[model samples]
Target chain A: MRNLPSSEAGAGPETVDATRRTLLQTGLFGSLLLGAAGATATLSGCTGRTEATAAGYKFLRDADLPFLRALLPGVLGSLLPAAGMERDRLLDDLLHRIDLSGYRLGLPSQKALAQLFDLLNMRLTRRLMAGIGPWEESTPAQVQAFLERWRGSSFAVLNTGYRALIKLVAGSFYGTPAGWAAANYPGPPPGPYQVFNS
Target chain B: MAIDDIYTKGIADGWKVVDASTLKQDQTYEADVAIIGSGAGGGTAAEILSAAGLKVLILEEGPLQTAANFKDMNDARAYGELYQEGAGRATSDGAVAILQGRSVGGTTTVNWTSSFRTPPQTLQYWADTFALKGGGEADMAPWFAQMEERLGISPWAVPPNANNDALKRGADKLGWAAHVIPRNVRGCWNLGYCGLGCPTNAKQSMLVTTIPSALKNGAQLVHHVSVRKLQFSGGKVSGLSAEALGPDGVKRSGVNITVKARHYVLAGGAINNPALLLRSNAPDPHQRIGKRTCIHPVNLSLAMMPEKVEGYYGAPQSVYSDEYQWKHGATGPAGYKIEVAPMQPLLGSVIFGRYGEELKTGMAQLPNMQSMLALLRDGFDEQSPGGSVEIDDSGAPVLHYDFSDYMWDGFRRAYLSMAELQFAAGAKQVMPLHLDSRPYESWEQTRTAIGGLQYRKQRVPVFTAHLMGGCAMGEDEKLTVVDSDARFRHADNLSIIDGSIFPTSIGANPQLSIYGFACKNATKLAGVLKA
Candidate 1:
């Protein structure tokens, strides 16, 4: 029920700094398994912007897109089409929906997600936390291993991150009609009622 | 076959409905009564007050979507347009996912239509524990009956949907008490789209019922206007300031609106209601503005049935088991009510909580998936003190909810019961919807696994569609924010006629409880205002 102005959608760099500063102050940065000194030294230089990029997503930046592109295939598995225009279109639609889904969430949820996105978007934190290099250069095996590691991790934060990522991707994918055939859902059943489009 | 869009037709017929998003200039509205939301409580109050000849104004932050918008029957569209935070509202820590509606009808718009009266046990507990007055079974029966008739609530006449039938069959085999659930509907198509908003307008939701009735009674309706704060002086509300939302319905549109009313009603339900009060810095000498909030914390288990369940095609919930809901005394241990959820592919996938090939494989069996949910009755014991509503730096509501060991105990028991029930219903495989859980082939295996399974927050999935009580109601000012009449203890000429006033979680789907309570309280308020 938090009503932020539309301008807040592109939270810009200040939010990222605040999120990082809070994480440092709370010692949660160390909980990410990073040494406090190393995290402060490295993360201070990581001025990653959270604003939506020129690629036209409302919440996800350009840096976030490639990361999602690599992760989606690993998460969707054979549910997604095997490399075709159809697969590209489906992924594009899911990416857009995911953006809206994240964008519409309350400030707290958006902030927490932004923190996760920031961590993944920066290369140093990405390497330290996820053990993967550039998302584009990362192999599917690397992405799968990372997801599995997070999912099976005993740390609550990592588990929470895994739930957030998987639910967002899987929920957005399965919610659309393009993802239904894999699950054998034939849309809403035809009944005695007529659908009047607005 | 064509269901007329009640809102379009009503607006065309000269109903004073305004979409704030379309406004070009700021506006000031004066009314005899101004209601802050248009959900079950607000809808009920609006019709009653307006029909009593008072000029009522209803304001909603959500859009004025109707049956027309619901015709798509698409989960994506529905969640994006109709739900709070796109149905992504969760606890502050994200351990529990919440499903509350944000449309004109509020949750009644998308609720599964399982209408149950305030369970007598809950009413009695509120009276004895909270010193709540005039909410006993006999005192509320007439109000319940009146709303039941008004909303066309009755036990479903059709055969149970396969998803619900499994619950009945399992309970029957186990000698547990099971019964057909009463629903608030008329001419229901059994299309299993209640959660997406009823396309046929046959579910008798407030959007299609009391709202239109209130409009016809000359009530003014405004949508897409977000209330920012309630201004008050000398223990009386002065006026409320609001901002108009753009077509996107998420951000402000730069047009300010002021509402001045003789009486103000807070019917925004649990979370938002407390948030509004907190944002306004409302007078709370007892510091009880956002305490004792109760969500009927739900956990679920998915069963892969041998036959074609097709859980997506029929009524979402038509049968329920109360075998464990009130087995023990209210304060002794956590109890739960068992019901089934429709297995729409999107919802199913999210609940399945798997990835890659396992998720793909599980969803491929969607038609055969029978999911049962256990709603733990919270807020009746010291162990389940319930959560609190706190505002973030942006003044947005953040629910601080954490499960106690007692609740985990309940979750463990509920998982075992659900798995056992599924096996009894002839499920080929059953899996608790937990991150660590895998499907088991028999009750014996499921029992052993569930007993040993980790009961932590991230390990076990938790959810809640029923949000109740933050500005709790009772006679004691020390323990309650509102009185038995639903009037704010600190504010004169202000009343809370929503689920936020519940002294405890009503051990059932609370739409009917809200309707009944609002009808009684609003009627009393109307008499006072008229006099």
Candidate 2:
């Protein structure tokens, strides 16, 4: 159990790598929301994969991948496992679980989430809805900055999107068993924990 | 050793448990009373109606979850199997998260078992304003006592958990009126695993009590069946259509079947009941089908304590303070009840409201965290006329609830009250559950931070477990879907015997309220049929 208060600056801080350097590049140049100018032009930068994988998870369109791949390490930067195939597996499971929940909120919410997914998944729409993207080209701090902008925005729509997206990402990440160490939540009850894990 | 599931024994002993997901062909069934949901209200009603020698059939939209399927308390499994929309159901814009259950026992299987009776003021208001003749505090006392006895409900005998102790200490220091919350459990192990469905069969949820009794008395329960519409003939509900779901419980696999009964009970809680009525195009001459739906929208104040709270252990909840509930009066500023939510990881993580290192830091303090949730009472005044439930283009329910300024004023006051209470309790830092607010190390800092925080729907965190009122029971056909007798005013033989029938929010946790209401109404229904 951790004894210190949050004023103690950091907990489980990590050093960034070269692959992460690829993430810190793009900025919407202080534009929190892309104005009418974004809507007028046809976006051509939606150049990510947009299909289902062989794993056969129900949701997560191909265009959705780059956005999530960019967002997770930022939203769950320190809590998520280090950058590798193991981390990739963890992210995969997180997205899959969130997708299952999407199926449960019925068709309307499913559509709304899918629309949000579509908007964020595409480079042009991501840039338009939120001012910075091609998220792979931005650092975790920049991504965090964009999220905080949405969280502190005067616009209700931006706040709503920020809340929806982060909750899905953060919830799915922290809820999983692999993410338990950071939260210090001893896994399940003792009896059930031993039964399931041991 | 794997626990020998109670359902296995019941099934072996010839309980009429039908897995609708495995149904092969279209089959019509007949019963004296057909209940649409199988949660707290429906389960209670089923036992009573069946015991009264009325043939009963229950259709549950969610799968039948038992000890066999509890899945080692994994939230992922529980939500998928036992919750509405996989525990992902939210309002239209997704501002408020709702946590209603969807399994055979409905929310009773998943609720934190704090049982509270309908407050005297609320019952009196119903009687005075809503044409409820015999539903005043005095008139309904016997029914309340009966359900309380039946459910083994009593004030928790054990000490409050550390998380709850903080609330008690704060209330005591401030000389506020706090009380031990009564719970519906027998031989409880004091485990905080109630939301995942009780593993030890100690919690007397309808899943363990009434549903089993109903089944024993020849009631047939079909799980994974979706009841679509109530078909009417001769001004009464004659039949209803249902589709059997597939293995996944979402896709329709079996042929459609119609159920006919002398009486039809709609116990699909608030959202689904209103959605069903709207879809069937039921006559709402006054257009009050889904208006005035109330949710006890809750806000949390997370207090990082100096000692280890480990809120995830012990009883989920056992203490509460109603000091502010009626301080401003029922009709004055919206009153709120103070309580704590168990910091189970999934729900706790989302409630923390941060990302990256910030969340990581907060997560590390989980053992030392004590949080208080102020369930801001809605629907008493015009300021909180309450949210409405409307259907989407696809006939699925879309709840539209926007927090008004009056409600925000109550929330602001609630944040201040909770922060003061937390500071008074011990050495700690407190933070309102807002995206913008940081952990304030002192009472003065908390007060200042709460004052400046933006009070908007998406900006602040909000949640509700107590979903109440939609097909409100009233005498005036223009104002309510059902009358005080719980019978649909426009349609004979149709009765809403659940939380939806509440004319207003029942000022406390609603399980006991629903249980008592069902007992009274179903008993009356039984008497009417016998006559």
Candidate 2 backbone collisions, by pair: A23-A137, A23-A138, A23-A139, A24-A138, A24-A139, A49-A62, A50-A62, A50-A63, A51-A62
The 10 consecutive residues of candidate 1 chain B with the worst lDDT sum are: B1-10
DockQ of each: 0.53, 0.26
lDDT over C-alpha atoms for residue A108 of model 1:
68
Model 1 CA deviation exceeding 4 Å by range: A1-14, A21-44, A50-52, A191-198
Q: Per-residue lDDT for B448-531 in model 2, tens only?
A: 999998899877789989889889886767678888879998778999999998878888999999999999999999999878
TM-score of each: 0.96, 0.92
Looking at candidate 2 chain B, the ten consecutive residues that score lowest on lDDT are: B67-76
Candidate lDDT (C-alpha), each:
0.87, 0.80
List runs of model 2 lying over 4 Å from the truth.
A1-55, A191-198
Ten-residue stretch with the least lDDT total in model 2 chain A: A1-10
Q: What is the lDDT of residue A46 in candidate 1?
A: 49
